[model samples]
Target: MAVRRALALSAVDRYAAMMISLAVFAATGRILGPAEVGMAVLGLTAYALIEVIRDVPTAYLVQQPETSAPAVRSAFTVMASISVLAALMLFLAAPGLAHVIGNDDMYPFFRIIAVALLLGPFERPLVALMRRDLAFDKVALVNIASGGCNAIVVVGLALAGFEEVSFAWALLAGNLAAVAVAWALSPYRRLLGIAISEWRKVLLIGGSSGLWGLIWRYTDSLPQIAFGALSQPAAAGTYSRAQTIVELPGKLLFVVVSQVALPALAAQRRDGRELKGAVLDSLAVISALQWPAFLLVACLAHPLILLLLGPRWLDVVPLVQVLAIARLFAPLELMVYPLLLAARQTGRLLLSAAIPACVYTPVIFVLASYGGFATACAYLVLIPVNTLVGYLMIRRELGVRATEVLGALSPSVLVTAGSAIGPLAILAAHGFRFDLPIGTACAVTVTAAIGWAAAIVASGHRLSPELRHIALLAWRWASPRLRVGS
Candidate 1:
């Protein structure tokens, strides 16, 4: 498939999944209190950390120049083994983990969620092979189907008063849906078999990458975990929600791009092409899209929370704003992992993750004791440090000089400033009140979007050409309909 088509499919999947997830969370947030949400958050945090390890074998398969049937089988076997072990460990540790987190009520939540882990080994290898071939249509189908199932189950159960365990059940339903869809759509069904002969090769390839992913994921889960264990009741849930809101832009961009980037970059490397240009181009596009969205989210956090999650979650507004600001620099490091993986610099990626993990884990744990806001403050200090470390590592591997990187990102800075114009004006007009009327909030969002498009055209950023092409295509498609109506 063409790269543009792949990206478009991925984007459709991500946006659809995002809308479904947002709806589910919105309903659940209203139905469940902070404590219940916090319990779910803790259970999901454990699940997330285990999920990272599952990606290792997938990466190994996708990065290969030629994935043999034996290798694919081995990858599944390894993934399945790891999933079973992790699920077992989580199940056995659930009680103790609940005790450690000072929430005996979370024991069942953890155990129930562990069941979802078993479904990964069934779906991941199939999806990875689809990704390797750039079969985004199938990939998108699997994701949307699974996400829809998850949303339906979660909302239904939450409404039925399942409380936090509703999320656990929803996860199981989603994974089962993913497994079934992936199996039906993937051409690799015949490749499934017991093959431990290639296990060594798979392990060697994915080990460092897996470790890197684990540590990277830890950076996200640590804050919530710490809050769950050390902070005031409901703090973890509030922080989780704020982090979720702040991360939406990044997640949307990253998921869509990275799904394409890894296999595409690996292909580019196999064909003996330079990677620096691709890396820089990715940074430019990601920043142009991501920074403006973050800025808008930061500016409109209050009204957004009120509209989407309701007044009960009003306390999340400030946390979202702070996290949005801190994550402004996040887009800079967005391409680092894909670049490193493409270059087969997995060891360097591991080191990069390790350095940041060591720096932030201790500090975030300390901050979590204070409160949700205090934990959010830690990101202010941590993200820049992490970004710097990641860039330094990327410079050494890809020779991406700081000056060149800055040159690439400068236009995005202008775009972000332009995007902020309408939102900031509205805020000022409203006397900087975080809580604006619903109609006024709608105005802020519309203005921000308009300003963003205007800035993209006015500044002639790298993304402008793509936007122009899309617009021309859109006009062409619409003109025929207009003539028919006339």
Candidate 2:
């Protein structure tokens, strides 16, 4: 029951964050030009890379509750040390990176972002601790408050014509707000003192974890960096917009899974059978939703992009289509990475990421350099291969058969895939010639509704027994508000 509450709270938090982000993206794009938006992406990418680098120690700390305080102190110390070092390096390298990306104007923006990057680590580990304790309602409030403050700051700055700097300031404000909120709410009482014994233990776990972060971040960021370097700012803007299309749903799933799965996996790590069942259940549920969502996004990308992002972003439609389809498998793939780590299979997780990093880096770079944005987008074909490797590694770690994983996912895939084709066929015949907004809304609404119904039916039209009980309780609680038509 506590686990269920954590999940519910996490989902609600994600939904709130998603709503804020949608508004932020739309407002920022409308107010700032494509070049400014491109610079904002650069700032975010740098921040994202640093965040990944710092997360290893924080994650190590959060994974073990008994040692959480000392581990968190050591993690904070490590983040401080690395933050100073990274700021120095970024200050030196910002000019070079700006030059490489063909945007000299971004150098100052990158430098300003360095300040916020240093501040982020302070709050990040605290939030992780809250999550470790299954305190997601508090976590949700913190995210909403921080993100809301950021939206207001960015919008105000944009109105004052701060342009690119507006986004940077917004980041600084959010990081600062999160630090305050998380510090106030955290249960682990610790000062900023580091112990050598604690450091050694954290380093042992986090150092290896650090390599994985480096590889994963470098791999993930390469696509964006490649786009920024090889393509124009406007083109980068379009590609970035394409990413948001794929990322919205991805972020929603990721938020809930990360919030719920990590603690759940840690609690059950000693029980292999239980762990296997949990993994299978999560795979079944997440894949059912993810596959259909991504497939429908791919099918509706053209009208959706134009409708959401305005005509300037129309060029992103094809790119969004490619990425959306590619990411259909991402939810399942992503689910395993956290479970693998929680089950002490970090080495396997690193190896899985390394395979793609080795194989696809040159491919993405080569294609982006010569082939252009669409060609760069074409690199999504590697996702299935990546998922297969991850699944194999996870199976090996759990001593489970690959067939078990595949078997659970087969029904959802078939049902949703079949249902999604209907709207795609409809869109094809009618085209986008009608009222643009109405047509796109109709396409997304009808397709998603049909796909969901099909999925429910194909899942035997029966909720999990646990789910059914929860639904009944909810209806009973709301019975006073219910009205039956005569």
Candidate 3:
């Protein structure tokens, strides 16, 4: 119930944030111009490189209970130091990076973005404490407020003709507001202090985890960096846009799970049975929604792009499909990373990520250099191998067998994939015409829902236990109203 509540609040927060972001996007185009907005998006690659500073300290705190004030203080102290140093370093490197990307104007904007690194560490202690107690309502409140504040600042500054600086200033505003809100919600008022022994333990536990963070962040941003270095400017922008389209759903899934999974898993790490049950249930819930959604999106990509993005983005159709499929196999890795975090087995997590980083770092550069169907094919080939290695680690460390995991996911994979057939058929039929109207899309959705219902019946009502429990919960509330209506 706590997890569900957190997820519900998270969903609301994400929706609200998305709306705010849309406003900012609109404002940037109208006021700051598209070029400025594009440059702001380009600057996030630098932020991604420093993102590990945010996660490592949070991990250190989340694993420890809120009562560990000394450790918290030490972690905060070290985190703040790292943030300041990172900001300084990024500011120093901004000119060089801007030069490399051949955009001399971006140097100050990059430096301004680095200021966010300094403030973000201050928020982590408060956030980690709230998450440790499952006090996500407060966290959600803070997030909504901060995101709203960010949009207002960015839009206002852009209207005032701040241009690129508006984006960077908005980042600072957002982080500061978040820190203030999170701090208000926090109970402790611990002063700054650092002990070598405590810092050593945090480093020992979170350092390797931080390495994985670095690897993950680097991989995510490497596409941009590589594209900037190797491909045409238009090519990099195209990849960014296509990625924005394909990764939204996956990124949302990641945000929700990443919020709840570590704390929930950590709470249950003591009992093997409980831990295993949690893992399977989480996987089932994830598979039930994500796999079908990915397939549906893949099948309906052309129609979707036509409707939302217009005819200009037709080139991204195959990339969208390949990435959706890639995300299909992502659960195996995502599920394992949090479990390892709960177990304080960051070494294994690092090992798991390091394998893929080696392969894909080069792959991203190649993909940037040569992007059409060939790039998509390389992704198809490499991502599964990465999943395989991660699964092996999960099995060895957590005693999570392939059979048990598959059993948990099988109902969803079967029924949901079956559901996608109608949508897939509709898209296939319209492929030659390329005239899928909005009504056609609606019909596709309705047909898919019917197919989903039929598949459930055909499967003898085999439902994921997680889904079944949710249904039963809903039924308890809805049954009385239905009885009265009848």
lDDT tens digits, residues 264-365, model 3? 897777654457778887877677667777776776667776664556557667777777777777667568788887886767888787888888887877
Query: Sorted by TM-score, highest first, which candidate order results?
Result: 1, 2, 3
User: What C-alpha lDDT, on a 0 to 100 scale, does residue 365 get in candidate 1?
Assistant: 84
State the lDDT at 94 in candidate 2: 82
Best by lDDT: 1
Candidates ranked by lDDT, best first?
A: 1, 2, 3
For each candidate in the order shown, give its overall lDDT on alpha carbons: 0.85, 0.74, 0.72
Candidate 1 residue 426 C-alpha distance from true site, Å: 2.0
The lDDT of model 3 is 0.72
RMSD of each: 2.8, 3.4, 3.9
Candidate 3 TM-score over all chains jointly: 0.83
Better of 1 and 3 by lDDT: 1
lDDT for 263 (candidate 1): 70
**Where is model 3 more than 4 Å wrong at Cα?**
1-38, 66-72, 155-165, 187-190, 193-197, 231-233, 255-269, 274-285, 306-315, 372-374, 398-410, 432-435, 460-486
Q: lDDT tens digits, residues 1-486, model 1?
A: 497798788778778888888888788888888888887887888788889887688877887777688888899899988888988999999889888777777778778778889888778888988888878889989999999999899889998988888999999999999999998998788897778988887888887777877888888688787876773448888888899899888877777567777777889899988788888888888898998888888878987887778888888998999999999867667687888867877677887889988999889888888788888888988999988988988897777788998898999989988888898898899898878887988898899888888899999988899989989999999999999999
Give the CA lDDT, 0 to 100, for residue 299 in model 3: 65
Instruction: Give the best candidate by TM-score.
Output: 1
Which pairs clash inside model 2? none
* TM-scores, one per candidate: 0.90, 0.87, 0.83
